[model samples]
Target: MDEQTFWELVDRTGPDPANLERLADELSDHAAADIRDFADHLARALHALDTPAHYHAVATSGASFLGVRCAAVAAGNRAYRKVLGAPAALATYTGSPGDQLLPVAERAYRTSTRADWQHQTAVSTHTGSNVAAWGTSWLHPHMGTTTVEGLAPQDYMIALRHVALTLDADPAWRSWWRQSGLTACELGIVAEGRLDHLRPSADIRRCADRLRANFTCASPHGGADLSARAVSEVRSMFEVIRQAMSMPGLPPTPPVPTLPADVPEVPVTAKPLAAMPAELEPQGYLTLTQIQEFFG
Candidate 1:
């Protein structure tokens, strides 16, 4: 079905999975290709909502936010747009269908046409931050007190540069690398040392390569395309690294570790908003103090 028609069906189906049977019945009439297209659109929509900011706005852990993401899509086009405009508005949604919709679509396709239905997109349906945006490094869990002390400063720099350039090619991968503290140079050194020590004969470029390999090997999520499952799985690998780094063996990282000169300094400041959207405010006339309460 077309995008407009798809959303209309979603709205008519409503957010409650209790009525999944009804939704399946409604979708049963569409062509199998249209049903698959509908699945792809739904997958993309879920992927779009899977962002660090949106995760934070939803006020839930990465795992729990899956349901919330589904709810946003199930709410239909207008509500989805509102959530995009004011991410915090997603906080208002609760108990949204998580992974239920796709299966329902699949079941509908299968039962009606007596044929298999499969998701055919690289877009991820899973919701959650692939990695935490800031704070304690995800690598801290895996490489405990691990530091490569013997590598020459120049050699370490070379490795760091290589890792940076390799991951920097992709914006999302680069963000994941930086946020997990891999860009610290020392972590990259540790990762390389750990990998090389683990497999002496392997031609390992750096730890990032190994991580990327792991992500790739876990690919073709749901046997369709590279789905979000890879990211969710890779996140576990990252968490282990982050934990390992936090153990009490190596000295703490330099308070002022040298950063690459090419890296731009991001100034910390809030961009002032002209006004809060009217929809965000509670219904009824708001007083001056209440207005300050909302803005402040």
Candidate 2:
């Protein structure tokens, strides 16, 4: 369907909860099962929203279940898009031709306290265009010391939008790598490290070789082309190393010196240990009383 038609349906119909439930009920047993599975997977995804590790896990799994080619989750504001290496156009929700549904999804994410609201879409086979599908789910903030209020709702919305877009583009293998906490640059560095470590394992070595090649081809400026699944795996591996390196008791780094090369050095001198008049001293040491008496 065209974006205009899809949006017109949304505007006219709004979100009919009862109608959605009925649609779910009308699905064939297998399709219904898949939908249920998708919902469950989404819940898990919400739970992992805040954690880098969990974010990678949920993003990867959600893409796989939904059959998307690539997916990403981001936190913070628009600055994160640059960090993730997304195209400048993709970073903002401009309500453009390809992104009409984004504003709706962003609103849902902002207001919904729970992580139950979700939106889906499909890619047109003929046009290679993304068409909006329906989605319902809540937003789940990452767990830890901070609460949901601590996070930027826009960031969550962007992540959701990415997942939906990937599902539309490639439902066969969900793409979750885009939502990972690690930026593309960070992923590349981690991948480089892994290649070095797994040199002994032929299978791993081969995989690493492919990853290295892909990394080179993508170029830091170009976009990542690997499946979302591969991105997730590489990101997960990177996280493991990051955590290990962050552990306590690691040797501290030495401080860098800041002294100037042109500064002059000062000289040092030592003074005599004892004080005695040379005139009072004879070939041998003179007793103090004898010397004093002679002087007197």
Candidate 3:
């Protein structure tokens, strides 16, 4: 089914309390299992890119793991783009909404913490086809060096070059099976759990089937409707899982931590990394002299 139709159905169904309750009960075990698997796979992907040399490896691995169409890192400044290569002018139409640029990154930098941002976009491509993009953005400080006084800009440039190369060469969709499969598993569990509790008069089965079909159709193109429903369902299931794992008669489970609605830009001031001369090893690290002499 098309995305518009799928979302129309979701809007029509709303969030029926009876359906949610049933879904929670039915999907508890499966949700738990899926979360565990997701965590494990995420951990492994991170481990593989733990080194500075492997930053692009990390991005590629994450994109593959998350089943997104494409993944990129965007720096706080318009001049800086992430994981792709070098600072450049922003794409004319690519500015994020003001509210979308919250202070999440600033807070993380201040605390030297890591944070993730989740976002979705719908845009008409040059070909006039609608393309949807949704994914997470992780912002954290570069752990290598806080001080680059003795370092030349070439050193930094070379480092960025390596990062770009890594991203370019690595697989774009690394963990599709684990992440997407887990999502499907969770959906199934929710559908089954609520099956019995739905009243004889209720069309819960039909609703679930519609959601499933819509979800499958939307996966390929990142349909807005399916994305919204998936986010809602996953969030609801997460809460259920928490409550089920909690002590009996305890207070309600806490909500999942959400990415900031706004990510404020944090200024990064650094001497631009200088480019190494053509004769030297292209990928090798540059020296302080090389940076000074080249740019001087």
* Candidate 1 least-lDDT 10 residues: 212-221
* Predicted candidate 1 versus true structure: per-residue lDDT over 62-163, tens digit per residue: 234666777787777899989877767877775454457767678878977997655566465443223333222223111111123222123233323322
Reference-based TM-score of each model: 0.46, 0.19, 0.17
Position 119, candidate 2: lDDT: 45
Relative to the unseen true structure, what is the Cα RMSD of model 3? 28.3
lDDT of 3: 0.25
Q: In candidate 3, what are the lDDT values of residues 149-239, reduced to their tens digit?
A: 3322232322222232232223332222122222221122111112211211111112231212101101112233432443344334334
Model 3 TM-score, all chains together = 0.17
In candidate 1, position 239 carries an lDDT of 49
lDDT of 1 at 269: 14
In model 1, state the lDDT of residue 236: 42
Writing each residue's lDDT as its tens digit, candidate 2 over 1-296 gives 23333223333432333333332332222232344343333233222222222223233232221111112211122232332343322223212121112233323332433344454422211111211211111111111111111221222222322432233233221223233232221111111112222221111111221211111101111253324433343334334533433522312211211222211222111111123578763222222232222212
TM-score winner among the candidates?
1
How many residue pairs clash in all the candidates, one count each? 21, 23, 16
| Candidate 1: segments with Cα more than 4 A from true spot | 59-63, 127-296
Per-candidate Cα lDDT values, in order, are 0.47, 0.25, 0.25
Give Cα distance to truth, residue 97, candidate 3, Å. Answer: 13
**CA RMSD, predictions in order:** 22.2, 27.3, 28.3
